[model samples]
Target: MLIVCHPVLYSAVVILRMVDRKLSEIAYSIRESFHDSGYTEIFPPAFLKSDKVDGFRFIYRNKIFVLEPDITLRLMNRHITENSKIYYISQQSDEYLNESLKAGSEIMGGDEDETNIEILRMAIKILDNLGIKNYNIDISLTGIFDSYVRKKDGQHLIRAVKSRNYPQIQDMEIDDKDKLLQIMDTRTRKSGIDKLDSIIERIDDPRIIIDLGTVRQPEYYNGLIFEIYGKQEFLGGGGNYIMKNLRGCGFSLDLQALSKLYHGSHERVEK
Candidate 1:
């Protein structure tokens, strides 16, 4: 009778039950959001061909998950029509592998909000729904779009990471606008930026301030760039990059660190 009572079986059953419950809750929330927003739930393949992404370590095996050859290829290969708005929901494995030889999976999804600003705004909305406020947000806008719209307004191509807790975000106290100007002019004339500059400078807009500064990830950034800070420390950053002639910007939220700033009570994990 004692042999029949296996500890591993009990523990595994409990874990599976907990996981199933969590998945149910997550699915319910997602379904509710999609139903309210007129979005249909979508499913993407768990395994894909790995591609060269900055800071990503992709593994190739008998099974290869790689980046699609081209954006056109992705669109062409998709089963759905192009005009359809997609709401992909799936467990995605990150290129980052753990010691257990398993890739970290996250409940990842994105809505095509169109512009970078709109995307950031949507992200903020999601955070707000979680009762998260008083956090810094990072946004990245492409220079092409920024140069066009920024002529009317100075804001463009900015990456903002939002966090409720103020990290070491300190203003460098850069009083000299001329210094910023010089950096801009010099960098604009450089190889890749020079081309982007020509397209941007063609438009005559006095409101636009073309400032120059280096971001943390150089390989990822091409044209315009910006970041947000809290308490003078960089909580998050991102930049615009032109790939396949499509300009896009993105940012990441440091949730682990941000949790420290939450005013709400914390619940301990059950062992």
Candidate 2:
């Protein structure tokens, strides 16, 4: 029997295969880098039972289960030993049922400065290994914003700062408003800037940008935070956080986004 298929459907199938192949290559490169850096791979369960619906929830055998939204959170629940380096590639889904592929590494229990430097270096090395050169890292210290949050009308002021709403920030009644404004402008060499400067001096990478306005996941990230960006889109980001009373820092890459960038650049080079 001869099977007949539409040309469009065939073309779509071919494209899908190409995409999957490229994604696999990207994941392999990331995993190789992790292994070379002495990090062990970890596999966490896909479905978790929790009262809080942080991810897509479903009923399995009359028991409520939620799709794992955060691999880091799941790792934290485990008894991670001190100075353990672990990496993972996992499928994550959010409350809206949006799924994404993440490749991440976590360094558990090490000197804060050393751990931060090591993570940043590893992130940069992985990007370089992938031949991704045109990228910038936006670094920030959450403590800067946390200090302001303790002040009166702090939340509103912090919101203004994050959004760069200068007028709204000015209208807020916070002490040292000018200083806060300066920090927002990335002009102040105060408090948290020193930490950024120290890291910059050690890393000596011009791609690192001091961005004090970045205060993402305040409840989760306690210290330094950084995001990786390609030419037009965010690749991924991570930061220092306390989990189960343990200090840890790590970063994750959006493997799908990364594959697109890597494939596009390589295709252009070949052409």
Q: Which whole-number lDDT from 0 to 100 does residue 246 have in model 2?
A: 81
lDDT of 2 by residue, 125-205 (tens): 888878788898888877776678998887787677766798887777888878887777773223355778898889988
Candidate 1 C-alpha lDDT tens digits along 1-271: 4557589999999977755554444344434544555545454443345444322244766644543222212222345532333343333223353111111011112223333333334334433443445454322223333332233222312221112111212232223434433433333322345533432344322212233433334344554444434444343344444434444443333333333333232222221
Query: Model 1, poorest ten-residue lDDT window?
Result: 98-107
Query: Ten residues in a row with the worst lDDT in model 2?
Result: 185-194
Residue 85 displacement in candidate 1 (angstroms)? 2.9
User: TM-score, each model?
Assistant: 0.41, 0.85
lDDT score of residue 177 within candidate 2: 77
